[model samples]
Target chain A: MSFALNGRPGVSEATRERILRIAKEMNWRPHSAARALGGARADAVGLVVARPVETIGVEPFFGQLLAGLQAELSAKSIALHLMVVEDTAAEIEVYRRWVSEHRVDAFVVVDLQVKDPRIAVLEELQVPSLILGGPGRHGGLTSVWADDRKAMLSVVEYLAALGHRRIAHLAGMPAFHHTARRMRALRDHAKRLELIDAVSIPTDYSDAQGAAATRTLLARSPRPTAIIYDSDVMAVAGLAVAAEMGVSVPDELSIVSFEDSVLTRIVHPPITALVRDTFALARQAARSVLAAIEDPGSARDLETATPILTVRGSTSPPPGDAIHETV
Target chain B: MSFALNGRPGVSEATRERILRIAKEMNWRPHSAARALGGARADAVGLVVARPVETIGVEPFFGQLLAGLQAELSAKSIALHLMVVEDTAAEIEVYRRWVSEHRVDAFVVVDLQVKDPRIAVLEELQVPSLILGGPGRHGGLTSVWADDRKAMLSVVEYLAALGHRRIAHLAGMPAFHHTARRMRALRDHAKRLELIDAVSIPTDYSDAQGAAATRTLLARSPRPTAIIYDSDVMAVAGLAVAAEMGVSVPDELSIVSFEDSVLTRIVHPPITALVRDTFALARQAARSVLAAIEDPGSARDLETATPILTVRGSTSPPPGDAIHETV
Candidate 1:
């Protein structure tokens, strides 16, 4: 049967035709389990996300990224086995179970943590896994990552050039490795630029937190002339907060989104953003993971192009004598 | 092995303990395929979506809905086999393949069409499938749906009462049964209330289309005093269009989003929306599909609660003399 199916030399053409006809008549297809038993590809990839369920819906990043992933993965008829877990512990448990059960050919690890336990777990499982974030601390695993430090530094330089000396960063969860990288970039650059006030406030990447942080920042005695948000949803929420508080965007206060999406482009005064094509990034990640699965240990750490600053309607020169703020 | 692992009456406690310890030491687990061969559950559900990949990412509905589905399905360790296909044909192909391969125990079909082909395919396959949107035309499959017509009628009633007679609807794809339902409900209710110039314009539900539609509508002579959007992303985009065109929301033109998310709430002059908890709806769908999987024909059609009107800062009576537009 294998010879016939593979068109091997031993199988006669007549026998092959008969076998194929019978298989068509019986609607026979290779079961994923049978394939697994034969040590063939499972034709599935596992993506276990650890985030609050509520946050997953409103955030556009995952939705767009999944689109790119699904587009690439579906062309090969490989299903994406997605599971949203509560935390990293549950995430690791999922990886372990899937590995032991031979449920998937590969895993796409996302939301890289500062001290990720899943790295050790995946290494022990000896599964072909691709990390979605990071150039380091991934423990010999292949990674596809955008340079967060470089992107953040470019955003700061752009803002500083616009005469924004006092800037506040609305960052995502502090535990994420990319988040740490972004914060460090901002802290180091702010000191180098000799800024009067530079601060980083970490949030859970929720619009509610974004709004609350924006309100607090704007209410300060000499409010920061600019604010940078980690996500597009947060940037839009912050813009709404600015609108409600009567602070004119790009006039009194400039805003920049670290991530870009339709949310950033559609809002009033259209947010300035560090634009990295997330869809393309996810497609590249998908291709890399597929490669890793096909030839284990062949996928290497890939550093994607840094996000370029696209200055939209949201950023401009700061208010009052801030022209002197430019170094 | 089964008797000892199950701790059956014939198996001694010591024997069962030894069996379990040995199994643990050997790092053995029940293979999903082995279970399938034994006619047990596949422990997975299939959700094949047919939509443009670009739309999937920007749209918040699927993201939120998937979050809900994952939360419920994860508790039982049932993986969601998600596949995004190009169209209905590809979607049906995936269903057939997944069914024949025994990859999923059940299917959760969404985006019900005016003439849904997948319904018949699932029924013929004798698979336990649940439709996500439908109170009708489902052909014996269990469904979990909110009242789209009733929800639309209520939205129209609310808007008409606010003196918006010249109302326009920015609808989603006309091929969708729910889209047709909502459009019909708006048309029927408009005539019943004796309103003037009520119309619906179908769109692909992108922010680009939403903005374009808004611009085209706003530029018309005696343009609509109110516009109802099918999605929150579109509503926000429409709001930005109004701002760009110098049309004040709820002053000259009121806006309402049929679906709501943080996008609606976080925007400037927060949009009024028909609030249905999509997360809750998805959980219900997950439960319904799981039950359908457990007892092949037991799951029944369930109509969830109709979305309630949540009027925020975006709705108001029409401007000036148009107050008399109220019936």
Candidate 2:
């Protein structure tokens, strides 16, 4: 039998009370109630990609991460509010609008640089955020990042064992926290291996830049026998450059790269690379972001990713006596 | 100036009357009144990717398209909601919830199958939608599609001009609309050119599937001198298979592929490919979806894309005396 309450037919007092109580508990309003109230903001999650669109599309990392986040959110029936900002300043503005307008429940931060300003902005606004990269060197927010230093060392050691003495690294922007760590690790590992010279070239993490950096490295008086690129796209560019210059891969110029994107596997000679389980990383990041949004106190926790090196055909012994040229 | 309407706050009676009249005329709530009634259902755009997360990450097309959409949406202060579903049924369910719950303003539909069920679902609900591929043989939906038939024919003619008579196609699933169109075009164009023995091998659009398809084609009685693939990743896999089989590219077998992804240019013996401006496609889809939401009547308009052929080093004439054997 249906009961009546609040001057409405077929509505029960107990049911109405329960509904109101749950709405208050969740800080949510019924769609009809919201419509009655008029122009009310909705509960959503905000994702700010702190990179240009052109750059983001060419990189495989963001695509996987976004896919994972979408998978989790779809199950919960939660909405993801995505924004692509050109720089950190623009990112700050987007987040401010989202928070002030009550447009989102949480934020997903990516590509964190050292002394990241977003962390400070998020803290001031008390906005729950989960960072895809580390909490930066200073550290104060929830973060999920792959072990770049260890991953770099693994590749370095692998190349060194292949009898390479002079190795050059084509790294991402110098300001990136992970880039600094990766560079340091490469240098330290090279020293430990008794390599004569270990040089680093900074790049903007694009294929064009990667190719240019590789060209400079190759033009050195005595070229490095092996090169390690910060990204798979760059590695692919390096491969192309090597081919263009008539340098035979794994013979005249061995190459190792990071990211392990599809490009690495598709090249005529598959590149030897460090493959981070980006799918796993994305899943972990999604889980962490959800946790941070649910329990703000958990925002201090950091998740670290371990990278595995997948060897293909890109690396081999240096040509003739060039292995020890720098030494 | 302060204005009073509906027996609340007033400075000028005429101004209040005008404001109320305008609100009624537009069938909308006043901005100030709406702002006061906060926390309602938000306006957002939803993107449903009907593909596995594991595979989506490796594909370059999604990444570029997503970035382009994000770029455009961010300018309009609109949020992009992303969801990844395993199949068509799951994608439809996600859309249903979003529509019934008013979680999104419109949807970006991707990877449409031959007789996509999602189209019917969207139509039944009268939800605004923009398809990323051809609207299929059963039209009645807005779609942004690249001319796959023209693209395929161009590849064939380009290879044929290079004196490649024994051409083969490594295509996507037989059931896919684009794949079917490309396959039909390959057969018809081959027939027109008197290359009666041309072959088309269907694949699942993955590297492994591509490799297997290529192997099967190569084992034919009179192997094809030039192979064309539906995707760049599959093309890469074909290259690997060719290498494993000790076939020299361009000398023994020429290759052409679709999607001028980064891998196309980076691989050794770079692949000649058809390049679709993914950025432009994504932007167009975003615009169409937004337009559909604003004006549902225009949702059935068809948007066509032309694929451009970029020649690299992957094509060459059939090996000496091999053409006669195939004919």
Candidate 3:
């Protein structure tokens, strides 16, 4: 058993194969509790989602990422144990319990917040983990990420080219690491292009919130001629708000959404969107976590492909008169 | 500790509170495994999703259902342990492991298939469970469900009243019990109305498949004046297909989707849909499973409220010439 499990290469191929077959027939899988206690592989990974339960369903991001993570984990016979918590404090409790009990071999962390404290806990526990966002301030924890700054910069540049001088970004959750990253990029790029009246509104990633933000932004004095949304669901809702308000898209106002979904394409004047495969990025993150588990010292931060802008009917040159008086 | 855990009625309220508070302060939690071995409680419920891994993310049904499930479970301080598997065989294995390991107190099962083998497995194991779909073919498992037939009948009646004689239903996977129910209802209802042309097409619930189905159905001679989709995603995709084909919705054709989503209300000619509170149904199921876990013999099957149809821009009187000719 040791020779087979540890790959000592001492037994003949036929003998090793026969032993493995017998073990399978006998249902002799390693018990996770004992394995965890011995500081050995539990053959399981933990992903704790810290978000309000009611809102978790509508966002496509987590579901897509889970599917991507499963693609790699299942092939290696690793079980993904999922837990949902309402906030950061509860999420921290989950990590502590899992670490103490050796319930999981490693952790796959996501939804990074400002000055994430999970890093310190993970470091103290000597647990193997992979963060799913940013090439930013992680405390030596291996991470796989996409370049959110570059992605945000591309969106701003595209809108600017379309003659959108005054723009408003309706973003989700300002405290999140990626949201902050995108906001910073938008500010920097818009300044570089000499565009004035660039603004952002934080939302809770709901259609209702997005619609409300669109209505409030449009009703303001010197209202922006162009708008960008952080999510497909929000973008779809924002478009509905515009339609209900009788604002003509592209002719009077231009729109862009950050995520590409089927929701984006079905709306009137299909939304111009930033397209990137969440599944692919998640797969890379899973692979990196697996690598770190086996050789913790060798793991390093890796960045996946940046988002690419897909031009569609929703974005065009801003309205001739609307772009001026404000800036 | 024993008195508080078991509710034995032998301890003072103040003493119990103090014990619980100290337990919390010390970061102590019951050992779920030991509790399970004593046939007490694991304080967790298992949800095993057996869907194709690649397609799990795009569908909003599972996500919404999960959110609804969490709302009830979290209130009772029960952990929702989620596992995603690829097939029934693997799902059965999960049930066995969870039952034997005492990892969960009960299960919440969805996506009921014909002659579901899961029923027999759950029966054999004597596991407490709640089926989220039909009150049908369960070997003695409690179930919570809504009337899909009544929902479909309402949709057909509404469209028929709108002067759409020839209609088509673009349904999802035929193996799912609810899909079969909806299909049967469509056939029966349409036959009673004596609609000249009625057809049902099966799809895999992907946007691409939805578009393909729409294209094929529309290319026929004297193509149907109206169509119903099994999901919000499919309906949205179908609408996009109609747009691309330059077919004017509500005039040249009408569309109705079975599930209500932000997708339905945000499209160009917003899709008319059958609306229901999935979150409520899921809550009932969660509560049912919890009750069954406490006292299995007392659990009973429950049927929730039927869907309410929401009229929108997509459904109206069909083209002047086509409606009468089909009749």
Candidate 4:
């Protein structure tokens, strides 16, 4: 019976088939928790988010990623255990608890930070874990990352081509590795291109912060001809800020968002944005994590497609007088 | 030892304390899976959403509600089992699987439909379930609801008071009970207030649909002076549509969103919105569902505060000559 039910080598094919048919007739299904007690797969993955809950509502990136994860995982009947924590400490504690309880088969970790403590703890646990952001620094864990540096460079090149000499970037949470990479990308390229007055402003990725930073930047003597936001919501808020201060978008100011979503397209002068398929990125992460769970310590780091800059109404050559543009 | 570990009446207080101390020293905590085999609580709640994966990203309401639910549930160390499914059938399958496996202690159901099938399935399964939207039609299950009808009435009353006679409501999916309630509310009052050209346009709650509907409406010889959207994203899309057609907001048109989020507030002309404490509402639902899990069949229907209409820059008396107005 054990052999038949467990589909082990001891069971003959005919007998196993007969037993499975009988079990089906008896309405028998393997209990997920019972299987976990017997050291079987939990058939679930955990995601512990460390962002403030309020930010989750407005940020399209997280939602799209979650949808992609769900779409892929649910196809295999794998449950997603989601928890939003206040900070990294709380997030790590969740990982510890879930690990000790054997509540999840694997974890999908996001929001990778500089010198992230969660990476060390996750490594120590020796559980199948995948980091959603990184080409490096996630020791022995499978990681999937998009090229943040390359994506930023494309944005800068596009803006420079549009004759935007003075540019500003609204970066998210300076402590994040991606944020640092983006800032550094802007700095390096800005120098190489001889773009004067290029500046990066760190923000919490909140609309309030985005608006405040935009207001401060717009008030400067030689304000940026183009402003790049790290997220779509911030770009919208920056557009609002431009309107509030009587700065017409694309005409007086060009705007670009690092991320793209319906929020970018639905605005008055639809924002020019760097478009990556976040859903596909998350789906790849889900597949990588599932592979890690299936073959622990074997899965390798995966790099996804670089975000492509899609130009729309909100970006154009800087106004004729501001930077002397040809096109 | 079992009594002490389980915290049952058979164990003496001193013995239980000593056992717990030793267990703590030994790093012995209850295994969540092991506990489930003994019919102990799963220490988790399930929320299976039945929306297309695409919509989840841009919708602020779901994220905020999730944040609120997490904030309340996690304080007591309960986990949220989240799943996004294609439709109600998939949602029901998830419920069945989770219930059979004892994967969750209770279920928090959202997006209540008129004559919902899940209500019956939940009751039949005898699981502790709470509907997040409903005052009626939920069969013997606990529910938490805000007054949708009252909220709609207030928006219409406010618009009437502002001297807007031509009102068009861009409603959400028509199958939703709340959507029906909102449509009916507008219908009932539009007659009483003698607001001619009042119409309700049902949509799938996508920004694309919102933009299309707005374009169609704006093309009319006598375009609506006021437009109310069921969601903040849709409202933002509508505002963009007005901009494309060169209709000045709150001058040629007034716009209001039934649900307010950062999206509504950060736009060029900040949208007037119906503000409800969605976070608080979700917290209350979490509490109610937890109570239902603790004492099955003991939880009752809970009515939360009605949404209040918040007037911002988006709403005003309809364009001067379009409708006669005072103040």
Model 1 TM-score is 0.89
State which candidate, 2 or 4, has the greater lDDT: 4
Ranking by lDDT: 1, 4, 3, 2
Model 1 - which docking category? acceptable
Q: Return the lDDT, model 1, position A296.
A: 82
Over the stretch A177-278, how does candidate 1's per-residue lDDT look in tens digits? 999999999999887877888899999998889999999999997789999999988899999999989999989999999999888887778999999988
lDDT tens per residue, model 4, B152-250? 999988888888888999999889999999999899888788797679999999988999999999999788899999998889999998998999998
Residue pairs of candidate 4 with colliding backbone atoms: none
lDDT of 4 at A98: 87
lDDT of each: 0.86, 0.76, 0.80, 0.84
Model 1 misplacement above 4 A: A1-37, A322-327, B1-37, B324-327
Measured by TM-score, the strongest candidate is: 1
Model 4 per-residue lDDT tens digits across residues A195-264: 9867899999988899999999999987889999999989999999999899998899999999999888
- Put down candidate 3 lDDT per residue, B1-327, tens digits, no spaces: 343344535445554454455344333334434445446665678888788876777877777787787788766656666677888999899889878766678999988986799988988888798888885866689988888889999999888888878889999888888899899988887778878888889998888898999998888888888999999989998898888888888789899999987678777778899998887788788889889988878657788999899999998899888766835
Q: Each prediction's TM-score against the native?
A: 0.89, 0.85, 0.87, 0.88
Using TM-score as the measure, name the better of candidate 1 and candidate 4.
Answer: 1
Q: Model 3 over residues A1-327: C-alpha lDDT tens digits?
A: 333234534445654454445334333433334445444675667888888876667787777887888888876766676667888888888888777656677889998777898888887777789998878767788888888889988888887877788899999888889999989888877877768878888989899999999999878877788898999998988888888888888787888899987678767688999998898988888898899888878558888889899999988887777556444
Q: lDDT score of model 3?
A: 0.80
Q: Which ten residues in a row have the lowest lDDT in candidate 1 chain B?
A: B22-31
lDDT for A34 (candidate 4): 42
